[model samples]
Target: MHCLLFLRIVSALEHRYKYFRFREDAVGKPGHTPIKKWTAAIRQLAYGGATDMFDEYLHIGKSTARECLQYFCEGIREIFGEWYLWKPNPVDCHQLIDMHGSVHGFPGMLGSIDCMYWEWKNCSDAWKGMYTTGFKGKHPTMILEAVADY
Candidate 1:
């Protein structure tokens, strides 16, 4: 996600859900930040990253990671579902086709393939030349080829 969008999500979720809010412990030690919990949740949801990975990087527990994921999904639905989840009407389709044609010279095209940078961590020597993301500043990056919401 873009930085602004990610921060917007973090801010919205934090305001809407108490679980995403930053808190202080009884000893007055600062607890996890909103970014930390949201990062753990988005990493798992978007990259399929392991929950244990956040334990070391984000200092979040496995159970908390799962909880974050659940609440993240819930918050997204509650916060953005109205504007983003509906199907496009015919007027919307016409506008999209017109816009795409003007931008890319492609008309009558509606479906879009969602592509994302995916780093290849354990690529073999022979396959190292194939994947290059540039997502983790790693050697290999793979473009995800999933058809999202189409």
Candidate 2:
């Protein structure tokens, strides 16, 4: 029972993450058809079947399947970067104090920064250094900083 419940929770989280990532406007070019078929194909391949899923759902050849998935990912990265690239706004102390007062039982924290680690495949020697950290192994990541004012 415990294992089943854990599996359900894991699946739900995975679905939520995937939905947020792919459903965002960042996944396709402006004025272009959305990459729903390609995203679904890649998800099916990664999570379950490659050939069967591609043929049944995508109706494309294996090589085409691979190409579509690759193209979709590259396009998504480019689009997302362009859309979300912005400088952080400076923090305002008065607004922060008011926000802290309104939300009772919460710590009066002015700002917060968090880091999330991801597992990535090893890369070439030259590129590895850029992706490496003092603690984690070779994985590419971006440091995102945001400031909120109440």
Candidate 3:
């Protein structure tokens, strides 16, 4: 069961990545050699491989590998949007509310909220401030707040 779930997640991620690559390609972006090579490296990592292995397999230096991974992650973020995408039906409110109540032990908690910090590299200082918030230090990042409707 766990393996099945893991495979499903990987498949979804790959599909989303491919969609983003296709969209960019359609816009007449530069050659796709980098994206293609990085995609294969990511697949190797997903299946089980070290960063060094990826570097050797792709013939990329450490710094280049880092940049490529960052590009891929950013691409995924761009296509997925900065927030959760969910469709809420008016007829399903009651059921959603009941489920939330049961799970969260609150009448209207709906969903959950969380935050994460990602390292900022190759970004200007001025832009870093806009991305950082709360107690976190300066870092080029994005804030993603999501909630369920009940």
Candidate 4:
């Protein structure tokens, strides 16, 4: 994790939500939950670290750590979704096509270059057969057929 970026996220969250403030508890005791700890918990979860490991290293409860991760991701999307995540315009699409053609010498290939199987964790049993490729265990799966230009 980039220390400066992590600190920025913590500061932003602290400014937006008072919960990140280091304050005294009800019994007039200083709180131990640091904004850095919350930030680390979220980062660890994003990196697929075990919940128990977070409890051991960051001193955060498993459930609380998970909640922190969820809230952090939601907060990021709510704050930065518009500018960072957006559909490409027609001009952008044309640029991608031209770039791909120049790089690979493919004229008609717009976007159909890669394929990947993704786990459908919450897929219903009724539709499993329809979605499943019948190759990867018993659970249903979905394929991501993408052709990213960048």
Candidate 5:
């Protein structure tokens, strides 16, 4: 996810969802939860990464990390579903065709596929050379190509 979008989601969840807020324990002591930990959990799950792999860096337990993932998914659906999750209508299709034709001289254009970089953290040293590509950077990153119209 983009950094700004991720931050916006975190802020929205923190304010709108009571479950994401840090709580106070006995004697008014603040709970140990940090919003970053929760964000990390959700990002990993969204990116198809292993939950336990983040335990070392985020200093979060496995069970708590799983809980964070669940809450993050639920909160995202509740908060951002209206604007982001929708089916295209006839008007939308017409607008897309017109816009693409006017801008790029192509009518009836849907979209194009592009490459995305993903770091290889657990890649073996011997295979790192094979995975290495100069497209994005020096790191051994797997390129993700996807097609999107909007």
Candidate 6:
């Protein structure tokens, strides 16, 4: 969520979709800005919280938050799906390997990869033993791993 990247997305979304554009209410007061709308959407997506959790802070109702989430998903899918939502072809893989070699002096590791330990609060007692790594006094955690080519 770098400011510039967020602004770039906001600009694209605001330009492509009227719902994302700022407007005035009936009383001539400005309504929600694109930033607020995107923020609500991103929070719901990134945090997986209740839709109403940040409504007060964002000055939007639960329904609006829900709407923002739905539309944000749809807009992102429509706007970025073509380039990002596809399997890598052979040519693409080769290019990625080359790019990685050039950038990091590594081979075939064309992207950032990471693993994270995520605490699983309220994990059932039966599964707790399977989830932990014998760490004393620590909650059970699951490892989340991901690879990304940015």
Q: Which stretches of candidate 1 lie over 4 Å from their true place?
A: 1-6, 24-30, 101-103, 114-141, 146-150
Each model's TM-score? Answer: 0.64, 0.30, 0.31, 0.60, 0.65, 0.62
Give one digit per residue, the lDDT tens place, for model 1 in 1-150: 699998899999999999989899899998889999998888998767667767777889999999999999999999999999997899988888788777767777765687777777788775565455455575787777875222
Sort the predicted structures by TM-score, highest score first.
5, 1, 6, 4, 3, 2
TM-score of model 6 (CA atoms): 0.62
Displacement of residue 148 (Cα, Å) in model 5 is 5.2
lDDT, candidate 3, 59-124, per-residue tens: 655554555566566654554445544566765666777878887676755456665565556766
The most accurate candidate by TM-score is 5
TM-score of 3: 0.31
Off by over 4 Å in 3: 1-32, 44-50, 82-150
Q: Compose the digit string of candidate 4's lDDT tens values, residues 48-71.
A: 655655665667777767667666
Cα error, candidate 5, residue 9 (Å): 2.8
Model 1 worst lDDT window (10 residues): 126-135
| Backbone clashes counted, model 6 | 0
For residue 125, model 3's alpha carbon misses the true position, in angstroms, by: 45
How far does residue 116 in candidate 3 sit from its true spot (Å)?
27
For model 4 the local lDDT of residue 33 reads 58
Rank order (by lDDT, best first): 6, 1, 5, 4, 3, 2
lDDT of 6 by residue, 1-150 (tens): 688989988888898899999999899999889999999999998867678878568878898899889888898888888977988888888999898888778877867879888889988896677777855356898778898664
